[model samples]
Target: MSDIEIRPARFESPEVQKVVAEALADLSQRYGGSGDDTPVTMSDFDPPDGAFFVAVRDGTLVGSGGWRRHGSDAELKRMFTTPAARGLGVARRMLATIEESARVAGCGRMILETGYLQPEAIALYESAGYRRIADFGHYAGEDGVRSYARDL
Candidate 1:
């Protein structure tokens, strides 16, 4: 935990972009093509309050997530964790970081879109005060995946 450094990542960094691309590639294969025709790039996801972040340990970025303001809501997106980082509370920490960002941005509620293919993600969200919510923002009904939201 002490080695973990959660900080903003730029879409310009090839390393960061590579991690994100790989995750999206997996998503693309899982959901019958890429999730978005014009996927949100890392640059499109960077942070002051609303931005993308990577949780680094030593020197490796092990986890990533982003929060974007969607009108009155802050939508969490692109949350991913490296396999090596699994079982280490990285996802929970990343979610907490995202929630902090949303709170700091003055957003009252946070929502997310996830897939059934990711059972671990479902459990994580459910345990973190999120509940089944109608698809919110752009990812609603695009597929039959589970969507959720939590009030901050």
Candidate 2:
């Protein structure tokens, strides 16, 4: 595989929007309804409070993810990799970059929510040292929702 470059990105940029849409579609197909109903804003991923990242390989966007400030912790969001980019380490690279960015921003831990339908995502987080935690965010207490956290 060619080198995958992870870079900071604006959550609302056209490229990012396209990637987000793809992620939503995938989620919808997996768990039904208009995908994730969690509310998010561009400012949530802006600097000083949060950071977003995109993974590119050979000049094409392959994956994206971001982290938002949650007290002393960072909340991961919008994590996804293009279907064609799967098994190429695009998602893994993007995840590492996002985690480091949050740690550098003074976050002492990272948290995230994923659905039970996403076994791949669960595996990734678990392999990276994340462990199950109390439910959180919009899907808290909802069936099929799983939350995880890791100390930075």
Candidate 3:
């Protein structure tokens, strides 16, 4: 298999938006909302506090993920792999990029919110050493939402 390459990306860039839109569309089908109601903006992924990234393999955008500072933790966001790229380690590579960037930026831990509907994502996180944590941020107290965290 060709290596997956990950690179920094502007959240507002069309390429990033295209992948993000695909992720949101997939989430919408499973979770019922478009995820547009959240406060995640381009500015949230700006330098010093956050970073966004895209993953490509064999010239195709395969996955995307990012980390935004939330107190002492880096909150993971937009983590998704294209349907065609699933099980190819695209998401795992993107996640490693996010975690390394977050650690470099002084974050001590990584956190994320996923839903019960996304068993694959939950399994991935669990396999990566993430453990259940209390609901956080916009997911706090929201039914069906689950949070996970791990030391970086």
Candidate 4:
């Protein structure tokens, strides 16, 4: 949409928290994730570090994605697109945007952990050149999350 804008979400910003919570709530509903965990949780990309972003269309946000460097590799977190905004290339654009950020930040590679329940998410990553990789970060311990990676 012409009004759609992709911008960084200030880590502690209220709007960022709202959108992220809504998105995670959606994911939790779809999968069995209780999502009781706070949506505003931290990572390498929060506030003093890391990055977050959102895609707003016609005043309503439709998608978001963010990444943070871990050693030399960038770890992507909080990537989500609302169903109402899917099939319009939103996810692909967000992925490219964040990957661009990674490249610009001097990262050599990028990695992410998605889930089996999210076929669309996995497909989007694969389409954007991310290949299946070992589970990473928060997903490292959980048996649920499936991870993927790609060179910048």
Candidate 5:
């Protein structure tokens, strides 16, 4: 994992878009849909208000995630690790990076929305100390959707 480097990235950068497309493809396969329908914009991941990141291993982008201000809390978004990087702690490192950045930006907590179809993601969040929280976001009240939160 020492070869993996996590760093801030522009949401619109080509490398970030590549990883995001891969992630959405994975989600589309998992849910048999066009992928997540939540609205997002490049400015949502801009610094000061929020931050986006990528995990690069040997110069290849292996993972991506970001956090955006949601009131006093930071909402985690787009966390994903390529199949080839699964179990390599790439997502974990990215999660830690996002959390720290949100904290430094004055967020009091971190929150996220995921689906039950993603057991690996649920496990990761639970193990990272995230607890079930009231449903929020576009997926709120939707079947199979789950939300979690952790104090920063």
Candidate 6:
């Protein structure tokens, strides 16, 4: 594999949006339903309060994820790695970056919501020290939605 670089990026950039769309589409199919597409926006990830990140390898966007303030914690959102880059540690790198950035911003913890259909994601978070937590935001009480949190 080529050198993979992860960096803060605008969520609205065309490349990011394209990957987001692809990720959601795959998730929707995996979950047996379509997604509503009504979540956070670019401004929600506009630094200090939040941030978005993308992983690029040899000029191709291979992974993406971001974090936003939710009450006193940083909420991870939009995490995804293209199928072609799934086992290259891209998602794990993006996750670590988000956590480090949140810590710098004084966030004591990081939280995220992923569906039961995404066992790989759950495994990644668990291996990284995240533990089960009560759901928050739109995921609260939503069947099949799994929530996890980790102290930063």
Best by TM-score: 5
After superposition, the stretches of candidate 4 with alpha carbons farther than 4 Å from their true spots are 36-43, 46-49
Off by over 4 Å in 1: 35-38, 41-43, 46-49
Question: Between which residue pairs do clashes occur in model 4?
Answer: 45-50
lDDT of 5 by residue, 1-152 (tens): 99999999999998899999999999999887768999989899997989999999989999999999999999999999999999999989999999999999999999999999999999999999999999999999999999999999
Show pairs that collide, candidate 6. none
Q: Evaluate residue 131 in candidate 2 and report its C-alpha lDDT on the 0 to 100 scale.
A: 100
TM-score of each: 0.87, 0.97, 0.95, 0.86, 0.98, 0.94
Candidate 4: lDDT of 46? 65
Give the CA lDDT, 0 to 100, for residue 95 in model 6: 95
- Order the candidates by lDDT, highest first — what do you get? 5, 2, 3, 6, 1, 4
Separate clash counts for every candidate: 2, 0, 0, 1, 0, 0
Quote the positional error of residue 6 for candidate 5 in Å: 0.4
Q: Evaluate model 2: give its TM-score.
A: 0.97
Query: Model 1 residue 150 lDDT?
Result: 94
Q: What is the Cα-based lDDT of residue 122 in candidate 3? A: 94
Any idea what lDDT model 6 has? 0.89
Predict model 4's lDDT versus the native: 0.77
Q: Which residue pairs does candidate 2 place in steric collision?
A: none
What is the TM-score ranking, best to worst? 5, 2, 3, 6, 1, 4
lDDT of each: 0.79, 0.93, 0.89, 0.77, 0.95, 0.89
Cα lDDT tens digits for candidate 1, 1-152: 77788887775688777777767876787676764453464445555447778889989888888887777788888898888888989889889988888888888999888888788889999999899988755566766668899998
Model 1 clashing-pair count: 2
Q: How accurate is candidate 2 locally (lDDT)?
A: 0.93
Q: Which digits, one per residue and each the tens of the lDDT, describe model 4 over residues 84-151?
A: 98888888888888888888888889888777778888888888888988776655767677788999
